[model samples]
Target: MFRSIRHRLALFTYSWHAIGPASMLRNSVRWSADAEARAVDSGFDARYGTDTNADLTPGEADILIDRHHAATMYLPTMDQDLAAMLAALPWPESLRRDATFIDLGSGKARVVLLAAMQRFRQIVGVELSPRLHLAAVRNVERVRDAGALVSPVRLVHGDATAFDAPPGPLVTYLYHPFREPIAALVMDRLVASLEASPRPAAILYCHPALQPGFHPSVFGQRDVFQLAVEGGRQTRGFLLGWSVWTNDAWLDRTTIPVPLVSGAGEA
Candidate 1:
């Protein structure tokens, strides 16, 4: 509950701006979220004119989460219904294998943390906020101390604009958390990374800004899912994207989702 009139007044004074290069409308809203006094209080979701607070380091996971959550004003990440849908989707590879998953712009490591518990062999969370990254690390230490899954989950404080995608088969997760300019830049680096190792890759995008038809032509085909949030009634939705580069149409003259003949299963 907003104890003071000053905070309550924000609802009327809310403002949102669409700042984009193309990936998603990141850096749009400025909401002061307080997670105090409640077991699970989803923070504020307001856009007060132009949020000018810039990015500040609060601590490892705490700071990274702030940066991640701050970049875009989405709430609680994706809803449960949508998350379940993603969990059910057929990944490029089988879940039985220790899939290499990387959460780009992994604010506070929530998604990545959950994945680590789900039995991924290794999970990496990349965040631009150093403070937030540390907070996430603390959370990890806490969970690990409590006997969570034994997967190797790591968090790095780095900018997504120019970070290198790990050289191997990996799942790049996106939350429609950043603007398109950054998104394209990150993708460009990812493409460059693939050019060297040329391993199979998949992208899981949720609450993504990229439209349904927003397919990366460089890849042969992309799998997408849309889960509408009827409670909100806006275009608010959950979308997941997975693109495999080596499987492109021009590559070996094939345009399909089937595993390759030679480097098929885990290329």
Candidate 2:
């Protein structure tokens, strides 16, 4: 058949052009080493995979609002990507010690574990999928028993749109976990919460390749950065973007101007 020949030709072209035998051997070794290092560094099972088997029944259709609005696919955050994001943020020890960090669509709760390890005042992970939520609970226990988690943490098994924001300044994180409709709803809720409480808040969004125009309207101007990570044969770069928005009241209360000394060095 023509399709069969085309598939064979495509495979042959890919093997010769993209991943040859030599490159495959080298990449395998590199990938193995990277995986081992990551497993040791991250106390949870943070392997990257998808939840393609997610099932939504007719009864649950009301919650999901049709299949298209259902749960987003599951993928664990890479440890290096998390590091890169934290590096870009204005994360002082005082903030980490006092802020409540929440992760929307917290699959496997890897970021929650990271927050716990960082000694955040409070750590919360909201996940809609029952499967991933259970996995997150187990991972939480594992990390706590290992003494990697130093702060109090909780895992909420529910829709992110319905979750309530905690009191205090927040560090909200999103990993491109859902469609725009759901994300928009959740973000609007968060902004409303901030407006009500008037606190400083920041949102860390990773893999924001979808809906480039959505963030500005929600989070205002976000600082964008690139993270270079190795895929198979070569290194690939991804966008790690975040924005900090403070309530007017919170800013007025907390924003203090730095005192400028004139001719102090002349003395």
Candidate 3:
């Protein structure tokens, strides 16, 4: 509750940058974030080995925060449980062997790295922020140096709207990177790409806050469920959704809800 209050205060203070008092508050918040990031040394954060969630000021990331109507202020590492849930998707073995995985708005390349570990045929990450992109590149190098990645992976520093999907079957992942307008643009581009190639495609969307912006008829059936693991330690359950479409015209019109994981499903 306190953290939420602080985050709201930070955002409010950020909005009033022109004013003297509010500017001071924003600066203090920025300083605190930087200090937190500085405290993390080499391999500090186990997930990405970098302090991704800290150090970024709203003013510095205006393009991501304002230009795209993105709600996330900084790049976030994909949770390990979510990665496991992705691995547990009911995809065909043959399709998994051949599919190219793409992570849109892949801030620090956590998903990209995880996909590589999953042995996807090809892995791609698209990020809009140059600062975050640079960090992702470095993280990629770190993993490569440690002999972690086996599959071909590359990071592209570009806007989501400018990305072109790879040919053949593909699995695209999104973690609520941006709001409706940007998400709509990306979905349109994906539809255009599919129209050109007409191959099997699946979109794995986590925390789909702006899912309604996507066209209803474009997808076949969608799988919606919350991920939960039983045993040793449980990672927090997160609601995830996936939609798969193929080249067939008639099959594209089918719309059904297939609940796969445990717990209640959300739209």
Candidate 4:
């Protein structure tokens, strides 16, 4: 617990240095209100709070940090921003009905619940932290009991890098889940899956890392994935960037809409 407090303090210090005090204050006020409203509307605890890794046991922390090179903290993606990102995708309704939606590093399964409300064939959330996974399970149960889920939902308590995607059309979502090494491995796994199955696949990356970048370029082979949409939303003046990449064989580039950089909430 002491270590977690220190880590959070260090993160706050860095954010204070990077964005200054006024912007930090504005974001905190606005985001807290938004989280409250979302929680009330959704009937679940999907608020922005705590780094999930902070709750990890010492042995778990050591193994994750030392062996995986994955240490990105958990922050729920904004409901509005995720909706805009999905709206930007030019997929046909028929395709959406056939494709499975998967949220990688799905903390508390907020994204999974949102996707469940969509027309996807199924919804899956892969989370590494046991603490977050249990919370997600509870939330899923609540959604299920309330009959709010349009599609079936599954929560997997496991590492994102090793999760094998089901074969067929897929829509994978990520919210800057991890560092470059693990991100690269996840991309490799996706590429291999596409190669073996040769199906339509799209990747939705929200709040992409800017430093030591983890973008579509991480896919390595430029011929496989193409950047279909690149945009973001501003939450009380703080920019949240997102991008969509489609497999080369899947999308009809001519049919895709121009990048959404305004109104929908791009800064």
Candidate 5:
């Protein structure tokens, strides 16, 4: 009995010693990421509050809009699968040449930059966060410096829900950009824009939890496209494509409030 107890104690002690360093390293990495996110977020807060803030341009450029949000909202870059998917999407031209790739709630312009590199002719990224907007601009510069064939990235700091749409088709990409209330308003604006033109508008949502509300409200239509790549790191995550109504195929749908995943109480 004594020998077995000693053996078990010895194993436990060794295990504790082995796990201590690993746990510390894991926590250190997490804290480092948190610190980096906070530093960027704080800089943005210092520059801009909730309202839109303008930027100092090198020459004649449109006055921009930038907003500041909490650091907890910091999101990592796009997954490799999605990046490759964006890179692989046949550069829409000729038949779909009018399609304009717009990244609504675009944080740091990661998606915009990637799509641009993949030959997206006209691209736009609307970001509300000041720090993220600046960081995204720098990221694009870095890509160009590194000789990456980056597409033209137009950064807008104004509220995406009310940003002006240039004359052309719209392909909005939303990666769970915002909650229902905010997303609903944005969707309404996008639909109104399309109604004025009567063109094809498709929303490629990476992580859509409230798309149901976004749809029917914006374009009076809804369609979900799920893409799963083999040997992809993304597990069980799929992109949601919310397409606008076409003149030939029309379907009037009702708007609905999208609830939070955890529950209504949390929202």
Candidate 6:
């Protein structure tokens, strides 16, 4: 309860600082209504037999709070947004079949479960919070029992910074999992992994923090990453955007007979 209050207060303070009192209040009201509507299962949960609708704040998860945790919150990726992200990947069907799909900071493994429905080589969810990791385990089991998973799912309970990307083609999904500090660490790890074992890789970042007040995303490394898709739409009064960053190696390999798929690159 106390943590929940603190979390709310922090959000209020941040919103006030960012948009002032009046606009903050207006956004708060609209966001609250939208959140409430989302809380109720809209057939996705019913069909999958999963409980991923709750917004699990750091406080609600009973986890230690740090600068990174404080900035992070758990909201399952919207079904439509995840679908759009998958669709935006430039990899052909053959490459996608051999690629591993990983979701960092996968809260309750919602994205993990959804990704399992695809024909990836493997699906992995790396989560830092123990509580959320356990929840993710249960959800994965439920999905497995229901025979809904095409690719085997693995849930790792650990920090994203320490996650070692398996060799071969990889696709990572991130939903603003942490602030810039932690994000930088995760990015370094990924770069190291790619360097150690050179391969085609891509990052799908939903609701990327690219605005002035927020820290810049590591995906902006132009020398290493090329913006493949950049677009967003208004959802429940909130403008949600996603950016797909493909490593230079992917672009280099696909430059020939593979035929590069076109998308709205970064301006």
Ranking by lDDT: 6, 4, 2, 3, 5, 1
lDDT of 6 at 25: 62
> What's the lDDT of the predicted structure labeled candidate 5?
0.50
lDDT of 1 by residue, 192-256 (tens): 66555555555655542233323444222222212221121122233334322222223233324
Cα lDDT of model 4 by residue, 10-104, tens digit: 55654454446776675666545544544544433433322222223213333353533354556677667789889988788898899999999
**Which candidate comes out best when scored by lDDT?**
6
Model 2, residue 170: C-alpha shift (Å): 0.2
| Tens digits of per-residue lDDT for model 5, 1-267 | 996676556434432343355554444444345334334444432332221222212111222322211111334333353454444343346524556788886666656765676555578988766767777777666666667644566888767777877776566776555545666677667766656665545555443221222434433323221122212222233223322223322212322346757866774
| Model 2 C-alpha lDDT versus the unseen true structure | 0.61
Q: After superposition, how far is residue 5 of candidate 4 from its true place, in Å?
A: 5.9
Clashes of each: 19, 0, 0, 0, 3, 0
Candidate 5 RMSD to the correct structure: 17.9
Q: How many backbone clashes does candidate 4 have?
A: 0
Against the true structure, candidate 6 reaches a TM-score of 0.82
Candidates' lDDT values, in order? 0.49, 0.61, 0.60, 0.71, 0.50, 0.76
1-267, model 2: which lDDT tens digit per residue?
996676556434433433356754545555345445545544445432222122222122223435323344455666666766666566567865788889998877878877787767889999876767887788788777777778899899888999989988787888767655677788778877765666667677764232232444555422111122211111232233433333444456545677977886776
lDDT of 6: 0.76
In angstroms, give how far residue 66 of model 6 lies from its true place: 3.0
Give candidates' CA RMSD values in order.
Answer: 10.2, 11.0, 11.9, 11.1, 17.9, 8.2
When 2 and 3 are scored with lDDT, the better candidate is 2
In angstroms, the error of model 2 at 244 is: 5.9
Residues 1-267, candidate 3: write the lDDT tens digits.
996676667655544442346444535545354334334422335654543444343445545545533534454543543465565455677887798998888887777877787667899999887877888888888887777788899899888888999897787877666655677678778877765556666666554221232443323223212122221111222223433333333224433357777757655
- In order of appearance, the predictions have TM-scores of 0.58, 0.63, 0.63, 0.73, 0.53, 0.82
* Lowest summed lDDT window (length 10), candidate 3: 225-234
Which residue pairs in candidate 4 have backbone atoms (N, alpha carbon, C) closer than 3 angstroms, thus clashing?
A: none
